[model samples]
Target: MRILVRVLKLLVFIMLINHLIACSWYAVGINDLEREDTWVKANDLKGKGTVYAYTTALHWSITQFTPASMEVVPMNELERSFTIVVIVSAMVIFSSFISTITNAMTQLRNLNSERNAELVKLRCFFSDHKVSASLVARISSCIHQSNKLTGSRVHSEGVSILELLPVSLKCDLAEEVFAPTLCAHPFILTWSEYYSRESKRLFLAARSSSLGAKHELFNTGQVAESMYFLSSGAMVYVRGDTRPARVSPGQWLAEPAFWIKWKHVGHASSTGKNCELVSLHCETAIRILSQDASTISGARRYAKTFAAYFDKQFDQLSDVWADVEVLQAMVSEAFIKHEKELLRHSVASRVVKDTKMPGLLRRMTSRFSGVSMASRLSSEEGMSQDEQINLILHERVRKYGVDGQKRREILGTRSMGSDSSDEVLAPVVSPVFRNPERRQSIGRGRFARNGLNVVPGIASAFRIMTR
Candidate 1:
């Protein structure tokens, strides 16, 4: 469009120059042709008279001509023709310029309208996704508190609100209620690492389904086209003859649909009015990932880790069990669900010991200690997965925080029990201070500093005892 406008302006400029030159030439022709000598010669033949008798005196000659007169007549006609041509050219160029300006204005108006339309579409998108004003404000608060571009850290010094709650309630707070809001946050999409944001947002952009009371999300045996995120209201997954588990908000449903199976095992339906769900179709998610360069770069790195984890869990759990719950349990322990059972047994063995006491006493003590360790593990296993993850995240975000190495070591070592041969050993130090002269000097210094003969006295007592 710009190029076309430029071309049209250039053409109009050329026509204006042509019009000016033609007018100048026409003016010069008129002035030269109207000079005294030219005009007198043009009228000289018109002044000639002929004598005649009284009867012929009244008769007039209608036709008369001279060479100069005939030439002037043709010149006048030629000048008029040149003037008309110039006027016509000027009019055409002027009209074209006006039309071009009109067209340009019309185009600009349309472009503005198009931009407004796009803005409206985006507003509608946010609305349809249930991104309300309060949700936006919550996201803003999270961003403000973190003051960081990445979700790697959280700034609040407080413990998680649901940290000590029961498994079901904690899951409700962390996974169902809290997580959906975080996933929907725009900053999480725009400011986090590319793959991190894409993986999250791809699911966030799923098509929304608004359901009234008792509407089903999917039926058992239905081909698994998408996995759903419940944004608002309540839903339940019902298996035959079983009381349905309440589908918590912010939780992913039918996750097996995305990977393990092509069909749903149980029927999911809304239990309340105005239930809102967003579903991520497998094909759409893959296509989005493929189109983005940043996501593609990290896809291989994270995908393999996730795939291995998923397959391990799938193999360990029964088909009738909920995959999401199993996944949550696996994440909390940093191990698969089956491994947790093994780890629990290992804990029991570590706590119970073979001692030199009476047989019945030893058995009683062993039994009690074993029960204690087992109970501890069971309590830990009961924590909600989201709560556990938040704890890890909180630890990671605090500056100058340890890597939870002590916790890991305690768990790892205790799980292996006393009989495990793979235990790591501390490095041995040489006994340079064991030399008599050095040992005496060190002991004397320690005694002097303390104003007590404690070190020297202890050394003397040890020697005497050994002797």
Candidate 2:
């Protein structure tokens, strides 16, 4: 991009110089109106339109400045002097343009060659060690990403970018870059929403690291010594008997460990792409929290609650994880499996006031009850069984005629109560001795909601075999 800009500036310079030369060429003859020997006057262009004069001047300017194959001859002494000056300027300007462009191209080629050499050596070195091709590719990706993020090549000997910055500058840089995010971190906020600049700085002092795919951050049951922050890329956290969960950017890993004595319940590793992680060690967190021990009442309570459920293993405890609480106050509303039943009952008992399709649970329960009591309701109403079945299976969940019956009311209420009770429903079957055609028709799904020619129910249709 820099090279392109340099070349563009040169092109503009050349065009501007050509424009000045063209104007000067046109002006020379006009300055001496009495002279008939000037190029413009000699060409009988004095009375000619400005177009003709400019065309003639531009012809000379373009040819001389661009150093085209065809050259314009000087016809008079002033023209000769002007030609000499133009020729000298063209030589210097064109020479510089050529030199600048050459240097830029050389630099670009050398940079590419250097990068290619490094990659070739990397691949060769990895291949020599019999590393899998896939892992080598991920390592290459890490190098490219590290170079991009740090704005320089990262060496293999374990030197880090943070070490390059002066101590005070590093603190200021970290404060500027990570202060807003770390300050509002859920765990940090649990300690206290507001902290001194120094307290925040200590959190921001967390160390950063770059890793390749499958680089393990922790082993199962390992002592949780640090909490990880995914700055970029993703990590997969694997807990026993559950699918791996992806930990995305701006999410914390092993957070509870940073606050209290805990061990990693699962393992975590970097994904296919490179990852940049910032880890706050337990010691660092302790030191930071110590500064405001009196204010960390909430954190202390949180640790106690977490310890109470020490054996419970969830997915990676990220901010975006399924059970994350956005607001600190929401911790009070959290419940265990046994507590969920009471909550469901409360929601079920809460009168549904919305006009739209009744509350989700209400609709589900009502639907279940309608189906169970479908055949029974048909017998009482002297209506065909098909009609009741259709009503139950119909997708338009709006309030309808049969849906308000007492049998439906009883069953629907039973469902809404979240009760597991002794109510059982009938199963469909062909009667003991019925018409074969009707039996075949019902067997062909003719009793389904979409069936156009409805099959008869137990009363009119078939000899449904039952004990």
Candidate 3:
């Protein structure tokens, strides 16, 4: 670029000099050839005789100089001087143009060489690292995308490869793998609405499975590389001897990694009958999330919604088998299991802790029917970390069997209530439990009113359990 600028400046200077010379010649009558013209004409004579003498003298003059008496000039000599000026101007323009082209060509050659060198370095890096085939495929995709944007390949006539390297790499490796089957995967489509165009592009780059094939999206105890979404057919997911959970079409399974980094807790196999899946590589997902803050927030919201759904589902499942007597037990077990699952994820603590106190308390009452220290003191909000810790410690002490009597005596109030039948505080059940519809109606009312409000019946039940 600098070279081009310098060439332009030289061209301008040459043109300026030519212009000045032409102007001076015009002003001084250097190329003028009339009988009245000065500079080259004879001055002592007049008319035709002087013109003939000037012309004859020019042909015979050995010194190439006019006589002192010359007052007129011939046309041929004036035309020759004008032609010489035109030739000089043309040569200046031609030379400047040629020089500019040569400099441009040289610079292009240098850029091409530099680009090749960078590509070679990338190749060496890939070879030295023994990169996986999948990664190589992604790199090739990035190169192809770069070429498309520039309308030419890196080695062919195109823009500088370096200039588009960032964009090409940013295009997402998943695009290459998923391009052919993007629309076929339901899982990608399901989350597609939550993402931006760039995020969608990342999804498009994901690896996709062939239609009507059975594949293991996750293997028990293995770190998951990608998350799979079923677009057609169903996936059978099994964890241990527990019943195999069938993941139907339009459902995806990658929640374990969403909240926390953990190995696959279960294995999923496509049912082999017209099943198609879209798989998003975890690395690509992470990259996309990092680039978009809104997406991160959206992801957290989704996770919370999922958690709530799971909790509610668990409660419903418990209700299927439990009577009033075992309801408390069932609820306790459910809470413990749910809490354990949530805490396994590093993100679980962050999410669970960030919920507003009133909302969190309400969710605890409705979902687990028990107050957990992790949920109650989770938010740091206005309190210091130490205060949170102290609050948790105090709660634990009050709940301890050995210290319960002493705590109640010191507080001069019944901390554990009047119940002795139950060792742990059971969820507060509505007074209308005897009537299913009324109980449900009251429960909904309480849910809407306050999450932490205690039910008189539940408190009475706790009193009975303690007794």
Best candidate according to TM-score: 2
In model 1, what is the error at residue 388, expressed in angstroms?
27
Residue-by-residue lDDT tens digits, candidate 2, 1-467: 46667778888888788889999877775677777677776677757788877777878887885747443466778888988898898888878878888998898788779989988998789879999879977777667655554432243225566577676776677666555545446545433223334444565556667766557778776766777778778989887778888888877777655433445667788887678777777666655554432211333333323322321222223222324432232222111111232234434544322244224323333323344466466667566543443444342222222332432232222221122331111232431221112344535423321223454432222111122
Per-model CA lDDT versus the true structure: 0.41, 0.53, 0.44
- Record all residue pairs in model 2 with backbone atoms less than 3 Å apart, i.e. clashing: 430-464, 430-465, 431-463, 431-464, 431-465, 432-463
Residues 1-467 of candidate 1 have per-residue lDDT tens digits of: 45356657766676556545434533434456455343223434324432221111111100011112122221355555654554565567556766776777787679668857866785687678989898766654543333322222221213455356665553343333334543542322221223333344454345555565665677876767676777778887876677777876665675443332235657888774547666667556545544432211222212222223433332321112444432322232221211222223334443223353323223223222233434444468666433333333233223112423432342331211122331222121111111212234433422211123333321121101000
Alpha-carbon shift of residue 103 in model 2 (angstroms): 5.4
Worst 10 residues of 2 by lDDT: 329-338
| Span of ten consecutive residues with least summed lDDT in model 1 | 58-67
lDDT digits (tens) for residues 375-451 of candidate 3: 66656578754355445544433344454464344333343223343233334232211122233533432221122
* Candidate 2 vs. true structure, TM-score: 0.44
Models, CA RMSD each: 31.9, 22.7, 22.9
> How far out, in Å, is residue 405 in model 3?
36
| Of candidates 2 and 1, the better by TM-score | 2
